[model samples]
Target: MQQAPAKDRIQLVDALRGFALLGIFLANILIFSGWEFLTDAGRAALADASAIDWQHRFHKFFVDGKFYTLFSMLFGAGFALQLERLTQRGADGLRIYRRRVLILLGIGLVHQWLIWDGDILVLYALMGLILPAFHRLSDRALLAWSALLIFAVPIAGVLTVNAAGWPPDAGLLALSERVAVALGAVNPQDGVTWLRRTDFDGWFSWVMSGPIYSWGIRLMSWRIFKVLGIMLLGMWIGRRVASGSLLNDRRLLWRVLAGGLLIGVPANVAYTYGKQWQTDWPSLIGTVPLALAYAAAFALAWPRAQRVLGIFSFPGRMALTNYLTQSIICILVFYGFGLGQVGYWPPAAFYTFALAVFLVQLLLSRWWLRHHAQGPMEALWRRGTYSGRVTRAAAPG
Candidate 1:
């Protein structure tokens, strides 16, 4: 008997993803304005008595770290759904997946160099290359690997630094120095380099030639292991309960809520004060727990979210297009190729700009999806991979 088609592509997951996408914009607003907003000295410059203190505090408390964690969880859930479709096809899932990931790598490389400084698509694509290896692992094995990756990355980082006899605070100091130089008021050179990077060929060069041969491969390799672990966790959750069904599982929801609050709240506090206090270990520890708390909370809340976050579902359904469109809009607003407003706008203003972009995309996505089956990029990917021919025609909704 023929198995029925997958149910209209998991509505709640899409909504959660859309919700995550909005948060991602909040996380990225600073970077979108200019590269300087994220650096230490830039933040210090923006944190004066005349600066908008409440806004900064709000962003730090609500936007930082939280949204990225949300995005990663959605990525994990999406990866599981991909594996389900592939496995049912009885094909070489890994080989096909590798090709798709390579395409994504190509897309990300272009996006990173041409668009913004905080591009995570390249990282995601790189992670995709190795996720298939863990696709077949048992739940226990998957959990073990996830735990190892989470613990091993930072531990390994610290051990390697120690082995090299580097100063305990060397990395942080160097980063601080870079920021200081950039924000020194008279350092025109640093400002110029920063602008050129975001506006010209510098981004392309960095992605293509600069150190891709060095730590690039290693970073991608490690991220793969990390992402695979997350993907397995999502799969485990999905297999345990069907969509809309998890809402009734109050005991599980309570467990998730507790785990998230227990870890997430404290970690966030530490991440905030620890940075201010210049305590490296606290920041590192806090970041890890925060990542876990994110997964736990999302897994718990998804069932309850189905009704609350309907608007986000439309955008999430067309995530690829929406994501890419964000870059397009940012370039138009800030690049030399467009308005060239680098170093001109404040962090708070950047967020306002991001909000406008979000609203436009949200409306556009809703309208576009009403008439078509896939977002523009998603349609291209479908045709490119399956037909080996580029079909420009959009699919009907």
Candidate 2:
């Protein structure tokens, strides 16, 4: 299939991606600034403890799981777009898609290993591998599978674990410890201390060894199912877009927005403040609904706010470059190898910093796209995906 010309590109999707990137950065900055590692006592001692508390609450309610869900959905939607175009042309869609996913996997590995441990690219790449299997399913079947994977699997896992009174598996804990030692830490705390105080080498070790433990925990927690489920939902949305129903149906958008507000908001409130639940499952349950609400709201507003909201499309167009760039910049800003401002800034300061960085990125993206067809990383990814057969066409979101 030929690449979609610029005029045919979906600017709203790009704008939504840009919006998701901003939220992801805000969520990730907690870890990037090293504030996530602070002890209760350490946090209590901060001058802005009350403000930080409020910020954390805000994040739990609005930011934490929501943006990633949106991003995952977007990824799925993009996949649906590619599959539709390729199938129409009778191309080897599966082979090309697998190759594309592998390229993404390679990029994610580099980002995860050398830059930061909070990388989602690796997870997305792995999840993307499974999407092709569901491409031929009916829309109803796709949504059924999505709901089952997103809500049912994670809830069941949580219930099973709670019933069994089990902790994280011992072998996984042992592997984590070994990974710590490989990073020159005597213990987990030592690893944290080393990361904050040591130079580039120490930072490198921490990031390089991170995935072993992180992925292990993620699997044990059934996060993959959640991610895969969200992608499937996105795929359904993509199909809607392809059929011209997504944007044309104002009634559907309104219903989704109403559901998100009535259901999503209250669920997230309980997830954020209800201590009796004693589990994060509420957040998981609420994430998709709220994310859908956000998307619906954005879509409803897009026609009226096209000029203003269109600013986000710049960064959205080159989401990969912007995402990786955020990681690299934040690493230098907070890590010991650069400014070493980790754990020093209050929550407000970090939020401000994140916004400032995003603004810069937005401007840079606008300028870059004016000169080049895509962001540097996007160009590289497209080249790799098409193996030089396609040139100067819009890649999927």
Candidate 3:
């Protein structure tokens, strides 16, 4: 990527943040569409070959898993930046980081149990809590740990799933299957579409149904090892960025960019087809490289794509607020707990709505950042995080 324009400002991170948010919206639309696979009737309803084929191909090959991993990288990098600042000032980095992460966990708990079940906040927060443990590791050690965690856990999981009579065999897999069953039984906010009973009742049911989907399925099937691994990998990348090692090594960056794509594209292709064989192995191995490829590609193209990247930078800067609000809007639009419009739109329509909302958010975020120092949620997080400490004036980012 080009120089960040200022010492403290890293606009490439913001662009990637915007990119990650778009991908997240796209991935979560399946839930907003009220897709259920538990019954023959529900499966039959979703069985339009023309409606699903292209969309499935697009998501499987491109949109699935990759962007979230990118987001994870940003998360780690952000923390690395903050910790460096704290350490330089002789501040208690762990306490400050812990408080901040705990606040994130609190927000995630509410988001997870009260709003939507598809929330990733809790997982990120939980993982953030353990991130500092890696702070002491050297660059090489950190990368090694990341690679070990990312690759090792998934292979172990798949093997366990397959090996009959293996100890703890299918424990995670079986639980995920059971959670899936429960998820399909519970209808989305009493199954209303294009209408509502009452706002109060709608909200009441929405709250009631939150945990059933969130904890029952989302948390149950949570891929802790993989996410943690990615986050750790992100932490290592963050260190590289903070150390200026990555930015200085243009040759290495291009090599990484080329290598990631060369390996990742084909790996994802295998993953797309691997589903037919009932395996997660391909995705477990492929998603990281694909995500790295996307980041490197964007960095390489940033100068040429400045106009588009500039547009994305607005939403990227206010990622936390934009991300949370997306869930709010989707719940209102699709779930019976609000306007009661579940299953009313096609896949493309759902994604289009998400894009339309994000476009509005992009404009609004641009306008908001013009005057305010930060987005609403981010401001609150900072205030809560540094409440008892002396703080500096906001940077002119």
- Model 3, residue 353: C-alpha shift (Å): 0.7
Model 3 spans with C-alpha error above 4 angstroms: 1-9, 36-48, 164-222, 274-279, 389-397
In candidate 1, what are the lDDT values of residues 1-397, reduced to their tens digit?
2221235237656776787788788766565566433455655565553464555555555666555556665665566666555656655555566666777777777776555534677777776666677767776886677667655664576567668876554344344334434433223235434443443343343233322322333342234344455555665555443343444465666776677567656655655542342124443345445555554565456545645566777888888788888878876676555677765666567777888888888889889999998789878766655543222222112
- Clashes by residue pair, model 1: 372-397
Best by TM-score: 2
RMSD of each: 6.1, 3.5, 4.3
Instruction: For candidate 2, write residues 1-397 as lDDT tens digits.
Output: 2333334348888999999999999999988877777776666666465786697678888897789889999999999977887767767777788889999999999998788876899999999999988988999999999999988888887888778977644356567667767766644664336657655557656776677767766766577898899899899999888767677688999999999888889888887774423137677678789989999999889878988888999999999999999999987888877778787777878889999999999999999999999999999998888775442232344
Rank by lDDT, highest first: 2, 3, 1
lDDT of 3 at 359: 94
lDDT of 3 by residue, 1-397 (tens): 5544434237777887898989888888777766422233543465565566666667887888888888888888888877887777777777888888999999988887677766788889988998999888887887888887778866776676458545332244344334433544233433432123345544554454544445444322235666787888888778777776675567777887888888788878876662432136557667788888888878777767867776888899899899889989987776655666666566667777878999999999999999998899999988888776343322112
Clash counts per candidate, in order, are: 1, 0, 0
Best by lDDT: 2
State the displacement of the C-alpha of residue 321, model 3, in Å, after optimal TM-score superposition. Answer: 0.8
Poorly placed runs, candidate 1 (over 4 Å) = 1-9, 35-60, 89-91, 166-193, 196-228, 241-248, 274-279, 288-307, 388-397
